[model samples]
Target: MAALSGLAVTGGTIAACTGKAKPQVQGKLLGPSFKAGHLLRKGINVVPTETEEQEVVIVGGGASGLAAARWLKKHSDKNILLLELENETGGNSAAGKNEQTAYPWGAHYLPLPNNSFTELLDFLQETNVITGYDAKGLPIYNEYYLCFDPEERLYINNYWQEGLVPRWGVPENDLQQIERFQQLTEELKQAKGIDGKYAFDIPVDHSSADAQYRDLDQLTMLEWLQQHELTSEYLHWYVDYACRDDFGSALAHTSAWAGIHYFASRKAEASNSEPHRILTWPEGNNWLVQRLRESCTDRIRTNAMVYRVGEQDGKVAVDYMDLRTQKYKRILAEQCIMATPQFVNQRLLSALPELLSTRNLQSFEYVPWLVANLTLKDVPHGKGLSLCWDNVIYGSKSLGYVYANHQQVALFPEKKTITFYHALADEAPAAARGKAYGSSYEDWKAVVLQELEKAHPGIQEQVEQLDVWVWGHGMIYPKPGFIWSEDRQQAGAPYQNKLYFAHTDLSGISVFEEAFYRGITAARQLLNTERA
Candidate 1:
């Protein structure tokens, strides 16, 4: 396990499903149908039969796009049209429902927000997550929405511990090393640079630009740990696990700045909740996305794929294929906010290549992820911590699973669903994505079962159904030097202040807060330009 630390798996083939399993167990594979979106790559030559003029057009329906639409709706009465390629507007934060409960496809929780994110707090208040402000001026969060007790647990050394950190059966020296690392992170959490700003901030762009801190981006997290002379097998596993959990990369693959930011960047404050406390729902972040969706529902168009983005008559013109009508549609707007991934932008904005000068598009490598939602007859009871909201298996390649219905207000659940997560970090992005796309439902089912069986022996018998979803381009990998690179910085720049970019990828971290920040920020930028 120690030897595998800081190493990636890179493009290993999934073994064919051969063994026999319980006859009651059945499963299916699900994900975004790439056929419509990929057709854009081949260049769509659809002529617009209809044209719609809007003051602002937002492309993509993810968190960023939704946030942009919501902000624009509240700030301006501009004619806005938001388009989404998928059947739904939630993007990766999409969810599904069964007779039992609701479950998430991607993001699941929002950490107690940083106090500086006043807009986010306001959003929370609108959603009732933040009920009101206290006498101390701290926000009062809804207790029901907060994660319940036994928040997390880890299966390590043949036992389940209280938390994800490997504490049980660890040697004294290793325990001390873990403590030291924790103390360092705690210190760095409040540590500010000479610029009078937090060394690491949640939005990432807001972090200090001090040379002392920015230099960390040049080296790998492993190198940084070694420089500090902190070498414990347990610590390595913890750090490597954290890097993979958040950035979808190993210590060696993750930038030192990104790795540390994972620990120090979040300092959420509230009157009743601690910094570690987070807000979640049965359907994960889809709850938040739904709130954003409601704010600008009339402007959002699903089953609409934007294929061409061009400048016409000193305005941004978007050409899209309407999946419902099977007709080409065009939207000419005074301003545009592109909330799609950088890769999609590369092709969509091919007409204006010079506008996107970020030449190292290859540097924006993404990691493929496998998520399995299993419906079980009953929750599996392991030796340690019964099933917590978030569960982990120490030294395992997978990030373990989470109880999809953990936030249920019901007294007890006889049957439940678990959402399993795995980042294919061992292989290169391209090769891994190819392999993931080529793999079969049986292949993924076999892989998921193999990992889960480690912690829950004979658990397959209890699984009534399993659904697998593969994210070909799951999340951005902040490899060493990529986070602070010039290409990344330029990638976020607004083109002529007419077209803007917004996505969690711009921050190199795929989290709800960053995506929200990118969306609201882009919308505000467009508003400022209109005023200017």
Candidate 2:
């Protein structure tokens, strides 16, 4: 990424889903810096005309990069610089704003954290997410941050249901199966392994190392359900939705351990909220990114892409370009953190593949995703429930939409905006990405209208503006054998005691907590090595 290499440019604007005299929908197709990413394949031959030195340098301005910078500044007096390819730094946790409200571009919400993750809890407290602790030592979360009432609703049985679990029109047998499955997951949430560790943990690495659980990583989530005889169509649909929602893969494609972790990994509790309660804002996790950024804004450099990272003169040499000015610069750091994805890392560190000798870069599989934020005059009420924070269609291709203003304290809004999500997981990653990149506004607008038209018959006419963002490689999913694989561990290991790696992919799951920890992990490693 040279200058604004991956800035979300308006691909095009069109009169969307309109005919005759209908007030035409407006907005442009904006997406990740896939163009800049594409340029990486062409190769780099850079001789920097400018050079600088830093005690530590961070490459990539995503959650991990920002977090690492935030932590390093708190603990070290060393010079540090964070290079980001895009005009903005949040990465998937990024956000945007319109007159109506703020909405998420990628990751939207963070569930209640496991209380035992004290570092995360501390960050939350520092950010005012956790107000204080209760008498029992449980966190007293800010009530405003906890999702307001009517938290989730499912459009099923031609009506809206109170919660996501299938109940309304499901057959009695299916309902029984759903209840049984819930019980099983709840049990798994508490179940530990022979090694005396929780069967599933949020970060995945801290989970039980016992082979019984590790073997589960080898099977597809579908295989696990089949073995358990939980064959209810509704149950499978719910499970698949969870897999796609969190892991961005289908039931058969997602590893069983990862799928189970979707349900079992969440054990967060708060005195003011229910177990697994979520904390959200109008801007989604971008609010968290803002909090993380607050501690280290001065250290971040936007529109700066590190094209090459190698060792030079006993230090890590990072060659980057300022996309805005077409100027090249180099930063020689005593230590560095590579927070970019392996897809990019494989190219930047190509000269020293030995640094990643133990890792199979090709083994990592990232899925493409579509997020559309539509500002509408109003959302039509389905049969049973009104607009809720999180909404989903029972058996739809899209993940439904979230009312972006759901967390707002405003009793009545002049307009409503909903952020819709879709994972292109019906096909292989290559095919899905091809479709997403090739599709235009007309192609995408039709898909959004089709999904929404069923629930709200005339939603197309209510549209004021429609903005689309495409994630070419949304998040790394845990495929069969990928999570527990040796490569995952090796991928995160330090190189030459001078370079360290930090990214959600290294953990094989792209939750906010994981990314936050990935940053801290790398920062601590760098700090500990320096102490040595």
Q: What tens digits encode model 2's per-residue C-alpha lDDT throughout 60-100?
A: 88889888988888888878888899998898998999997
Candidate 1 regions with alpha-carbon error over 4 angstroms: 1-21
All candidates: TM-score: 0.95, 0.95
lDDT of 1 by residue, 66-179 (tens): 999999999988888899999898877888877889998888888998899888999999999999999989999999999998799999988889987889999999999889
Q: lDDT per model, in order? A: 0.85, 0.86
Candidate 1 weakest ten by summed lDDT: 1-10
Go through the candidates in order and give the clash count of each: 6, 4
**What's the CA error at residue 474 for candidate 2, in Å?**
0.4
Angstrom error of the Cα, residue 469, model 1: value is 0.5
Supply the global lDDT for candidate 1.
Answer: 0.85
